[model samples]
Target chain A: MQKNYWRSNLKILSILLSIWFIVSFGFGIIWSDSLDQLQIGGFKLGFWFAQQGSIYFFVILIFIYIYLMNRLDKKYKDKSEEKL
Target chain B: MDTQVLTYIFVGLSFALYIGIAIWSRASSTNEFYIAGKGVHPVANGMATAADWMSAASFISMAGLIAFLGKDGSVYLMGWTGGYVLLALLLAPYLRKFGQYTVPDFIGARYYSNAARLVAVICLIFVSFTYVAGQMRGVGIVFSRFLEVDINLGVIIGMCIVFFYAVLGGMKGITYTQVAQYCVLIFAYLVPAIFISILMTGNPIPQLGFGDTLVNSDVYLLDKLDKVTTELGFNAYTENTKSTIDIFCITAALMFGTAGLPHVIVRFFTVPRVSDARKSAGYALIFIAILYSTAPAVSAFARMNFIDSVQEVQYKEAPSWFKNWENIGLIAWKDKNNDELIQYSSGNALEGVKPDFNNGRGLSGERLVNNNSDLSNSNEVYIDRDIMVLANPEIAQLPGWVVALVAAGALAAALSTAAGLLLVISASISHDLLKKTFMTQITEKQELFYARCSAAVAIFIAGLFGIYPPGFVAQVVAFAFGLAAATIFPALLMGIFYKRLNKEGAIAGMLSGLVITSAYIINYKFINVHLNSADNWFLGISPEGFGFIGMIVNFFVAFSICYFFKKPPKSVDQMVDSIRNP
Candidate 1:
């Protein structure tokens, strides 16, 4: 049961980190040159991510995590209480 | 008709209003002092929070900072605003639920240790002081600019005003004053932007003014700004010339830092209910977005105006505003050649408000060139960027009443935040330092007395910082955000959600994070300053981003220690369950 939580936490962490990396580090920094080639309403894709897009993502990520954490807390809560 | 008399009248009137409010709503009990009696309306709390969070830096320097750094300055806009998200979703609600008087109180209880609270207090003081120093400087700057007073004298005058209201009502005083400030500053901020926007884009709303195509021009506002600046050997205003890593890290750090700031978090605690706290966060951001969104437009408009009006002009034939700003000492023009076509002034461009020109010739009959002039040349044109916002009205030739209102608004921004910061300092000394650590059984009256003294001391120290600011107002503020990011942010997040994380691990994590993060910033800012326009910052990660590194280290160190240490008290899981259940 402990191992299951550990596994789930790792999975969530990996998914979160990947999103963070892709938006900020990948599109914003690493793949910036390629992104600059593409424009969003006259703003380069890379530049947009750097300035505005990632902030929006950050807001989304926190909400997702908050919602997920609340659910996780519920799932891992005392089964004895439910049975009673 | 003197500007000084007008300034004194408006400032004095505003001061009278704040003092009167303090007398009416002065905190009668500790709870009232610390959390505005936990009865603030959501929108009211939000307005106060906006005022508290948007300090002198936001009021005076943010747009100018953005104007100069071009696209790279998004780090501040994104970082500061992004922190609100972190605050809303992660930190604010839980902290409010935690039901603590101060951040250190939460840390102390969660860790079940006084040592942890002490560390938290230390970091809070360090961070808040760094921030307060910037506010002090901003106060001095505004005073010197508008009232034609010396910087030191201006700071002292500011100190007395802050001491007046902040000394009375604590959080209650600040909250009410901040609401009033929000009105004045926002009006001051927007009225000019609206005028400028309408002039440039035929759009009255500053937010829309930014992206709209320029009037009688083919290009968007930002694009035009980009072209003009780039042509004048400045970075293209809309271009992302910073490394992605820096932007990411800095923005992340600021987000967490905002969430961690005890003063800002404490604002949410003023509301009565959990639902109120959550609702307040949304409303606070909405109020802030009014200024935040409008700011970028103002910055763009200002930059476009700056370049359009002043680029490639002969010394003699420079525009009237240039000579005006030069007389105050913001911009200088000089030719090495003994040509009569040059103008040069320095120290402060806006000092005298009108360049006398002394008949358009240097005393030596040689033109000053490239901003070099004598030390005594108080007449030299040296405009501080912080002046950009306050001076925006006059620079764009707005009405005198609008300019007067802007002055009032500038004071509102500075004073509201000052009151908030002073409240925190008072609480730390009164509640944490005196009541908890020293005199454990002190009476309420004695505690209040000590609190007042500590506030006086803190104001004095803050006054000193204002008189002689160590750095630009915004950079000093970053230290506050950085310290909070490093210390409280990680611990609070872990404590609320991770039941297994114990006191020992939290202390270690917070201390290590504080030490490491501050060391990085200190090393960069003071010990080893190198780079062009701070462009050589790591991963292009400026000092603003350094705290994110510290936060990660804190989390890892904390988790690692947790793995080795015992689990938190059995009660922690139950508490977490209760919070999550709701």
Candidate 2:
């Protein structure tokens, strides 16, 4: 059961980090020029991602991780309690 | 009250509050000193960490950097905050679970080697001092302007304030003081930004203000800036001037370096549980993002305000802020063409205009003196980048207290980070080097004594580094981040995940990464700086980006050496397993 929990934790981390990578590095810096052709409010899409979007995503990613991990911790605790 | 008097009042009050907190939370025991007795609330720790993490650079220099760099400045934006994601997801909880007082403590026990601990200490000290020197200098700059004091005297005053709280309170003192600093610095930063945003874009929120149309025009803020800067022969405000590869590497280095910085990582240790460590990191970033997101807007607003106020205006008719900054040797204007009007365009230096600094025949102590004695043609105005944030309120004509608040905020940012770094340096000396290795039999009282004494000595040296700074230290400071990314981050990350990794591999990995990254940076940035252009770069990689490559080298060397070594002993494997668990 502990092994399963660790596996699931890694899975969640990988998924979130991939999004993190794609937003800041991939869209923000690498493909920024292509996206700059498109505008959002006053900012180019790619420019906004670089300056603003990536940071928002990072904040959201952390909260989501907190929520998921708290659940995982509770689940693991209940399983061990039952075994005891 | 006048601005200077208001500044004195605000700064004086903040210092009193910090010293009071230091006394209130004074650490009496080793436990309290090192990790705040492991009782800090997660939210409070988060705020303190935010204060500790946002240094003088973030408070005073970053908006100016972004204002000038435009798209290129995104390197700092993404690089600095992105590391928190890595910290939260990868390292913080695991390190908290390990239950150690310092980064070296984790390294020493994880690999079970004194040598590994020693290497970690050296890296921590080197990175911490390089960073602290910059902060000391920042404090000096802010002091010189607000207090009308000499730069060196400003540094000395800043040093005394940091020493008071750091030696008395240790981690407990520094933590609570940092929380107070977080409030001061954030308030000082946001108030001006909100005011400027409303003035420029009719939007109170700086983030939205960046996107909204100008208050009196339909043109967007950024688009307008792009037009003005390009017309001045500067790169368009939002266009990328660097190669994508360079940006990628720089951003990567900063992210990894931010995650790997020892002082920041230590904040997670002050929290109660592994889960709280994760939560604390999230909260820390929220506090950080408040400033980070607001910075770009601040940059855009300041840039537009600057050009509108100065460009093409007669030097004689320039605003009082311009003349006031000029008196401080931060702003300069000469009618190089004898036209009496200031021209500020990139590459507009007059063909025969000579820069005259030693002659003392110009405003602000330096000027482009026209050789013909007729100011026929020369780029007549010089503006220091540091003045953008400092002069923002003045340029916008805000009230005196707001100007004073910015001064207090700059000091708060510098002092909090300096205190945190001083504690880390002291701990490395007393705890990591002395108590752990050489004098294991030392009494607890003696250990605390060593911590306090070492912190004083560290501050003294750090002050010297600030006052008589080496010519190359400012340039070399950037490499500190790369060095941390290369040496520390990989070791800590791999130590947690790879059970087969032995001490031999860890030490070898760290040494190789440090040497190679430092050599690459020195060779290009300092040793042969003339040959440092993109064409001469290795794979077009600037020294700033070398950390990313250095990290890859560390992983390869570590894993390859691990393959040849005997599998870790059962005990070492169990240590890894335990860290991986709760």
Candidate 3:
């Protein structure tokens, strides 16, 4: 159960990070036109996000990850009293 | 407000900010000076790394390179960014876990030999100095243009600013200052790009603007650029004229080389946990992408703006931007009487046009080139693409505040990267060479003092080089990349994965990499300055790409020699395991 919980958490974090990476680096810059076909909020979904939107998301991701990791470290304390 | 006045205000504000941060955050020890005391937050470290990674080349030149080279410029985009992937996956976490202060520290510990560390330090110094030289040149360019000072005075001023922060704040100072710099440089880069995108394609966002069809034109941005440049007697924008094999090798070398850059890798050491190291690389790229993706837009827009501005008039009518930029000496064209002439006659002769006073053209007569060199076509015009970013606001007639922001941005790019490179240079000299190698028992205070001394020395040399550069900024940075590609990268990769590779093999590989790569580069770039076709490079793999060939020689020679020699002893396996395991 604990292994499954940790594994699931890792997967979720990885996906979110991947999205963060793609929005800023990949889609925003590399494949921007493909995403630019769609519009969002007076902005092309791809290019706007690449320039401004993706960076805001990345900043948010880092803070969230840091908070989550702190909780995780506390909740999953080693049975033998190991502490970071 | 005039743009030049705004520029002074912008540059002044940025200087004050960096100096303030440097004063606030000072490093006290070898540990803090080298690696920020291993207490930095991942996000902050990410920002610092972003600032460090995005040099003047990335800030000022990359977009132009892309606009000019098209798909071929993908080598730079991929070669640079791809290194981070290698860093995140293959290098960063392991190096962080290993807990080394510098690259040479790892080399020394892993090999259990001073000789190996010495070799690593030599490579680190040579590579870093070349890189720093480029950054210094970038700083001088930014200063001279914005402040209207002599280039040497500009370099000296830049050296002073870098010294105040790097020497006083050390890594701690640089980290906080770079966060501020990231904000300035990124804003400077993105705002102009946004305007140009809006102007060209009616799309406010550049990344999408690039792909969307040109405003009222059916062609895509890339396709338009391709067509336009081809029409203008230039190579097709997207064709891969380089040999496929050379492309693959050179790109791979750059990837590995970037991954092994000690300055960039050292930034990861600041974050607390191994996991932060991984996340920081991702965030760094995200921050960098803001500029990187936008760069192509800037390049394309500027190129389109430039060609549009200059074509159709004749020798006397080139736009105001031409002469304005020529005043800065970045764009030089020889006129008659063998004098370097700035032309405004042709592009200015358009029926309904008024030029800005900032253009600096004389009122009546158009500036035309004399056929003094006796060439048939006296009307040829050439502009270096580096002027694109600096001249963007002027070309587009954007507000002066926007123009000022750009001056701050360019300096931020050069200074941040120079500080990062200085830390690496200092570490290699003070910690790696003096403290560890010769004077292990030296006081911590003395070591810190020496590190600061080294910073002052490196910055002085780098400033001098920047003022009177041995080569152009981008070209010199390429030499740094080539050195990294040849020496440290192959050694680091082999040391991790190939346990059987012994110290002797690594040293031999490094020496051969340096000797062979340096020889090839010198032969082509400098030694053959006499323009000897006989001394021309092999298979047209220019000096920049020759590092890739040198790497192959290093690897082949190391492996072959190792094949003949004894395997790494049992202790080597234990050392490799230490780096691999938590």
DockQ of 1: 0.21
Model 3 regions more than 4 Å off: A1-84, B314-317, B333-379, B471-475, B529-540, B563-572
Indicate whether candidate 1 or candidate 3 has the larger TM-score.
1
lDDT of 1 at B107: 85
- Name the candidate that leads on DockQ: 2
DockQ (C-alpha based) per candidate is 0.21, 0.86, 0.08
**A-chain TM-score per prediction?**
0.85, 0.95, 0.64
What TM-score quantifies how close candidate 3 is to the native fold?
Answer: 0.83
Best candidate, lDDT = 2
Regarding DockQ, does 2 or 3 come out ahead? 2
What lDDT is reached at residue B25 by model 1? 80
Q: Give the CAPRI class of candidate 2.
A: high
Q: Fraction of native contacts in model 3?
A: 0.01
Ordering by DockQ: 2, 1, 3
**Per-residue lDDT for B1-582 in model 2, tens only?**
899999999999999999899889899998889899999999999999999999989999899889988999999999999999999999999999999889999999888899999999999999999899889888888988889999899889888888888998999999999999999999999999999999888999999999999988999989999999988878998899999999999999999999999999999999889989999999999999999999999898888898888888877688988877766666666665656677777653534333333335544333434333323323456667777888899888889999999999999999999999999999999999999999999999999999999999999998997788665766876788998999999999998877789988999999989999999999988789889899998889899988998998999999899778877788877777777778
lDDT of 1 by residue, B283-331 (tens): 7877776787677667777777765554444555665545554555555
What's each prediction's clash count? 18, 5, 9
Q: How much lDDT does each candidate structure score?
A: 0.74, 0.89, 0.74
Best by TM-score: 2
